[model samples]
Target: MAATKTRTIEQLVAEYAEPIADAVGLDVDDDDRTLSGFTRLLSDAADMLSPADCTREWLEDAAEALTALGYVDTDTARQAILARVDGLLYEAKSDLESC
Candidate 1:
């Protein structure tokens, strides 16, 4: 019998993070602090999201963490970043609703 390889949380997160950013026009750099924060947030959110544990508080956490990175300076950028985070959550939320 062949054994199947299981992916770790980090590997799974790496799969979705960049594509999610790309979807919302977020140009995330590896060295960018905002990107670092976002990556951490995504990994944290993964456990809650994988089984579709959707909650406003989770979304808020993401927004708060991203905001704390000090990247979203203007109202416009704030909105954009939140929207992107929401977009990622929305995917999880939608999956929850469907199941």
Candidate 2:
């Protein structure tokens, strides 16, 4: 059997960034400021998520990155994070039910 390759978060992020953005209604032309900002935000989030250690520190960095990007306010970012977490938890629960 061939060995599996370990892909970095950055690589995966870069590959799916456009489609992910599109799903979230962020897909826009290259010249669009909103698209650029979202791309930068995605890159920052990927960097924060790429490490094995310092999970809390990485979350803090990610939160800062969200606000520093200047498109999303702190409250909005917090709400968004919570929303995603809730969605994931719901999905997990559904998966467990099926299992």
Candidate 3:
């Protein structure tokens, strides 16, 4: 039997960051920035989701990485990033729930 591949949140975030940034007309120089922004957004979202949620840790780690990378600051900026991330997360969750 072949092992199924499971993608880490970081990996998934890295994969989608640029397209997301571009979709919203945000200029992201690299995957790092996108990852950071995604992380910050995820962290904020995690607070609203239950601990049993898989996204909890992913969001927190991504936010921490973004903070370390100097990508996030100020409540307004953080909220903006979170809004975008949340949108993506919601879509993903909906898709998963339907499956």
Report the lDDT tens digits of candidate 1 across residue range 1-99.
976344322442355456544433345455423455555545444534434455434544554555553664676665555455555556644543455
Residue 84, candidate 1: how far off, in angstroms?
Answer: 1.0
Pairs clashing in candidate 2?
none
The C-alpha local distance difference test score for the whole of candidate 3 amounts to: 0.50
Candidate RMSDs in order: 13.3, 14.0, 11.6
lDDT of 2 by residue, 1-99 (tens): 976344322443354445433433444444323434544644443353335534323333433443443465576564555344334323422332343
- lDDT string, candidate 3, 1-99, tens digits: 976344444555665555434433344454444555565544545565567755555445445544544555665565555445445555544533443
Report the poorest 10 consecutive residues by lDDT, candidate 1: 4-13
Query: Which has the better TM-score: candidate 1, or candidate 2?
Result: 1
Model 3 lowest lDDT segment of ten:
19-28
- Looking at model 1, residue 90 earns an lDDT score of 60
Instruction: Provide the lDDT at 96 for model 2.
Output: 27
* Window of ten residues with lowest summed lDDT in model 2: 88-97
Better of 1 and 3 by TM-score: 1
